[model samples]
Target chain A: DAGITQSPRYKITETGRQVTLMCHQTWSHSYMFWYRQDLGHGLRLIYYSAAADITDKGEVPDGYVVSRSKTENFPLTLESATRSQTSVYFCASSATGTNTEAFFGQGTRLTVV
Target chain B: GESVGLHLPTLSVQEGDNSIINCAYSNSASDYFIWYKQESGKGPQFIIDIRSNMDKRQGQRVTVLLNKTVKHLSLQIAATQPGDSAVYFCAPRQAGFQKLVFGTGTRLLVSP
Candidate 1:
C-alpha cells in the first residue's frame, strides 16, 4: 500500500476506443515511466515524465499519451486504441534517473479487440 | 528504444545448479545496466544494477558483470532454486535519462 499501484489489473477494450491506464506512487519520485511488454519484444517505453509537468516520448509513442500533472500520479492514455496496442502495461518510478533502481507496479493486462 | 538483447529466450536448469543469463547492449551512451526479475502476472522487479564504471556487482545470490568493451552484460545466479524460476530482463539506461531500454527476457526454469 505504500509503493506504486496500477488500476484495473486486466482490461478488454474495443478498437478505436479511448482507454486510460492509471499509475500512482507514494514516494513522490521525480521520474515516472510507462512501458508495454509484448512477447519477443521485451518492454518498450511509451512515455515518461521527469517531474510533475514534463513528459517525453520514448520508442513507441504512436497511440499513447501520458501526463503528469501531479508528482504522485502519471496516467497513460490511448487516444485511439488499436488491436496492436494490446500488451501488458507497467508503471515505474524512481527518485532519479541516474543510477537509482526503478520500482514497478503490478502490470495491467490490456487486450484490444 | 535501443536494442538490449539476450542470447537465449529460455533456459532450463536443475535446482541447486548455477544459472547464467547473458545480455548485449549496443548503446555506447548507456551508463547504467540493471537486471530485473518478473514473476508471472507481475511487473519487472529490480534485482541488481551495475554502473558503466564497474565491471561487476554482486547481490545476495546474484552477480552482474558489465563488459563495456564488447558492450555486453551478464547475470549469474548461484544455487538456482525453484523460486528463482521467472523471466529475467536486462535494461540499460543512459546517463541522466529516465528512459530505460529493456532486453527481451530469458525465461529461467529451475527444475527440482
Candidate 2:
C-alpha cells in the first residue's frame, strides 16, 4: 500500500516483557509520530521524529521508546511493558511538523497481562 | 497544561439533520486545529481543519468553526448520513510544535 501501515494489529504480552510495534509509511514523509489511545485520554503523543535519527519525546513518553532510523520506518518499543501500558497505538506521518495534516495507520492493539 | 475536550461524549441525530460536535481547548495560543473521524478499528481520518486566524472553513460537506476568544471549536456536518457514524476528535496544536494533542472524542450516531 502507499499509505502508513502498522504491524501486529493485535498483540498480547505479559508484564515486564518487551514488545515493539512497527510502523512503515511509503509516502516518505519527514515527520513520523507514535501515539497511544486509551479510554478517557484520547490520543497522547508518545514520540515524534522530525527526520531520520531525530526523535523527540511527546506528551506521554515515560514508559515508551521510539526510534526512526529510516524515513519509512518508525517503531515504538516498550522497554518493560506494564499492565497500564495496554492500549491501542497509532502511527502517523506528515510532510512537515508545522500546520501539515498527518496521515495515520490502522493502529496496533496491545494487551499486557 | 494542554487540554482539549469535547462537550458531548455521544451525539445522536437524524440522517438528514445537521450534526454539530463541539470541542473546547484550554490553550488560548493554539493556532491550528483539526477534526478527525475514526470508524471502528481504524485510525482517525482528517475531515476538516481551521486556523486561529480564520473563524470558519468549509469542506465538501463539513464545516469547522474556530472561536479563538472562547477557545472553542466546532465541526458541523450537513445532511448527516449513516456512514458518518464514528468517533470524532478535535486536535489542537500550537505553531512550531511537533506534538498534536487530541481530545477525548465524541461519538456521532446517525439514525436512519
Candidate 3:
C-alpha cells in the first residue's frame, strides 16, 4: 500500500541462473537500500540508491547488481546465483540519506542450490 | 572499523518482569541510535531512537539509554509481556552516512 514492498516473498533458483528481486516504495523516498541477512552477520548492505540513476556499493556488493530507473523502484539482480548467495534479502527506503527514518519491507527468502 | 554489537545473544525473562538489552558501539562519531523489534520471518520494526546529544529517551513502555563516553547503548522494557518476545536490534547511524550499522541482535523470550 503506502509502504515499501518486496516481490517474491520466497524464491528458489539453481546455480548459475539469473534472478532479480524487486522493491517498490510508495512514499517517494530519496534513498533505497538492499541488504542480505545471514546468521552471525546480521544485515550487510549490498547496494544503495540515493536517487534515480544514482547508486553506490555497500559493505557487500560483489556478485550482486542493482539499478534504480525510477524513484519508486529499486531492483537487485544476481547475474550468476551461487550457493553462497542464498540468504534472506531485505529492502528498505528512507526519505533522505542523512538522519532520517527508514522503512523496511517484508524480506525475500532466496534459496540457491 | 566501526561496529555495533550486543552483549547477549538470547535472554529469557518472566512476564511482567523488566527486560534489559545492552549494545556496544565502537564509533564515537555516531550521532543517532535506534532500536528495532523483529519477529520470526519478518523485517525489523522501529521501536525507539535516541540521539547522541541526549543520554536517555523514553517511549510508551520502552526506554533507550546512550552513553557516549563508553559508546554503549541499552534498551529497557518495562512490564514485559508475552508479545514482547522478539529479536531486538540496536543500530547506530554514523554521521555523514546513510548506513545504520546494526547489532548482532538479542532474542528476548518472555515466558508467561
Candidate 4:
C-alpha cells in the first residue's frame, strides 16, 4: 500500500520552537496540498505545490511555510509555533486531470505548549 | 469569509435507513464538487464526485447530487450501516484552480 505517508503522527512542542511536518507520496501526482483541521473552522489550506519547486500560499499561510523541492515530497514548516496553530495537519495530492481525485495522508496532530 | 459549509453539524440515523448530508457553497465559479468521508483519527477518504454539468452521479451504495443553480450538494447513502459513520465533507473547486475549498463538514452517526 504505497500511497501517502506523514511523519511524526503526533507531536508536542513549545510555542517559540520550530517544527516541520513531512509528507511524501509515491504516486508522483504533481499536485500536493497541506491543510489544517480545526473545530468549527473545518479544513483550511495552509499551502500547496503544483510541481517541484513551485509552491504557493493557501488560506492560512501566515504562521507556516511550505516548499516542494521534490515532486514526491512536500514539507510544511512552522517557523515559530503558537498555541493557535495546534491542529491536525493533513497532506494531500491529486493527479493532473478532471478526475483529479485527491488522496489524503493519515494526518499529524500537533500540540503547541 | 464566505465558504463551502454544511447545513447541519450532525445527523443521527438508524441502520438500514437512508442518510442525506447537505452542503452549501458560495463559489459560483466552482466546476467540480466532491464528497469525502473521514473516520476518527484518520484523514479524509474520497467517496464520490460530480461535475457541474451533471446533477447526479451514483456509486456503490452512494450517490452525489449537485445543483449549480442553488449552489447545493448532497451525499445520499442507502441502507446506512455502522461502518458508514464518519464526518462527511464537501469540497468544491473553481475552474482553473487545483485546490479545493472544503465545507465545515457534517458528522453522521449511524446506529444499529
DockQ of each: 0.88, 0.82, 0.69, 0.81
Residues A21-106 of candidate 3 have per-residue lDDT tens digits of: 99999999999999899998888889998899999999899999999999999999999999999999999998874567678999
- Pairs that collide, model 1: none
Clashing pairs in 2: none
Pull out the clashing pairs in model 4.
none
Error of 3 at A109 (Å): 0.2
lDDT of 1 by residue, B52-108 (tens): 999999999999999999999999999999999999999898887767889889999
Q: Per-residue CA lDDT of candidate 3, range B73-96, in tens?
A: 999999999999999999898888
lDDT of 4 by residue, A58-100 (tens): 9999989888888999999999999999999999999888757
Candidate 3 Cα errors over 4 Å, as ranges: none
* lDDT by residue for model 2 (B23-110), tens: 9999887888999999999999999887788999999989999889899999999999999999999999887775678999999999
lDDT of each: 0.93, 0.92, 0.92, 0.93
Instruction: Give model 4's docking category.
Output: high
- Give the 10-residue window scoring lowest on summed lDDT in candidate 4 chain A: A93-102
Kindly state the fnat score of candidate 4: 0.69
Per-model TM-score, in order, reads 0.97, 0.97, 0.98, 0.98
Model 3: pairs clashing at backbone N, Cα or C within 3 Å: none
- Residue A40's C-alpha lDDT in candidate 1? 86
- Alpha-carbon shift of residue A16 in model 4 (angstroms): 0.5
